[model samples]
Target: MSTLTDRLIYIVGPLKLQNALMASFLERETGAKCLAVEKFHDIQNMDNENTGQPKLALWDCLGNDMESCLSEFEPDFKEVLNHSAVAFFNVSPDLGIEAEFIARGVQGFFYEHDRIERFPQGICAIFNGELWFSRKIMNEAMKKDKKQTGLQTRYETDLSHREIEILAMIAGGASNKMIAEKLYISPHTVKTHLYNIFKKINVTNRLQAALWAAKNLS
Candidate 1:
């Protein structure tokens, strides 16, 4: 089992010195290995071995406005996001895009004026499988969801019985390993089923798939 102490963290930003400083501070506070990367693409090269370990990436907003920050992610953010849980830091207040970030599978937000001491606590919480969202962000995400009473007809017709079972397990917050153990299969097979489920449902990420199941599945 992965514990908080053995997790990995990436502090990705444009400023090398600042990133290094923050990484050092976090390593001291959290007792986890921290790496500072100046370029986002550089992360793909550095860590290739620990696929099963829980990792978090802290992306710097770099004082850009919300729209520009989002546009910066257009190139290859999805691939990065799939590998590690991501949180945005140095964000300005009242961006009104928190809900959008949630839709895109962002796990947390750190505002520009937020206290520096809070970083370690938030990072540790996220590392321990918790979403480090603010109450306002949580409320915004909730308000954006559309409530449904039962499963949708198209989903019932399109998804196979096994696919539906896996989807339900996903919606119930089961991880791949847990699902695999429950269903007498390997984690790779569970991943294969999830990939097919994403394609059939037209969703890009796990959060979207879970939300789809929530709104359309009973």
Candidate 2:
């Protein structure tokens, strides 16, 4: 597995001092370079000059009003999604509004009051191309999956169970290789599954599939 030293991590939020302290902690814990940005525009400016390397972003939505912050950050979040970078939300511990952010293409969700020790592990999971949602949030997401029993009616009628699984993983921000590893299948098989999933869902790429999964599956 790769360490955080392999890539850059960007932390964005309205709380400048909090973000800076969090960045410092993360840097010390993981030995990964961390940047604390006050706004999405700062990220955009930095990204323009960034070398093409793997990067992860965390949007801290703890201090501000959730609805207001989400509304203000939606467009910037969409831009992050377009870049295919891993983006997660640092939110209040309550799972009340998680689905709203997930619908906006957030890959992971972290509780603001979680122990700082877990931060490194969560970051490593995301860095390694896996999800980092809290157990409660993950269970809620899975429960939502179960509640939407009529998959055929919700999405394309032709999508099989395995295809739906792949789609959900994609929406959870897993790469093809990661998906294959999790399912104990080869990368080629994962690609084949994705191809069929795209065809069934009438989507052209992973990003489209992800968005579709978020809207329909969740």
lDDT of 1: 0.75
* TM per candidate: 0.67, 0.68
Candidate 1 stretches with Cα past 4 Å from truth are 1-3, 145-218
Candidate 2 residues 23-51, lDDT tens each? 89888888888988877667777877766
Residue-wise lDDT of candidate 1 within 123-210, one digit each (tens)? 8666644466655565456457653223345454478888889888766666677789999999788889988999999986666776
For candidate 1, report its TM-score: 0.67
The per-model lDDT (C-alpha) reads: 0.75, 0.70
RMSD of 2: 4.8
- Highest lDDT, which number? 1
The alpha-carbon deviation from the true structure for residue 139 of candidate 1, after best TM-score superposition, in angstroms, is 2.7
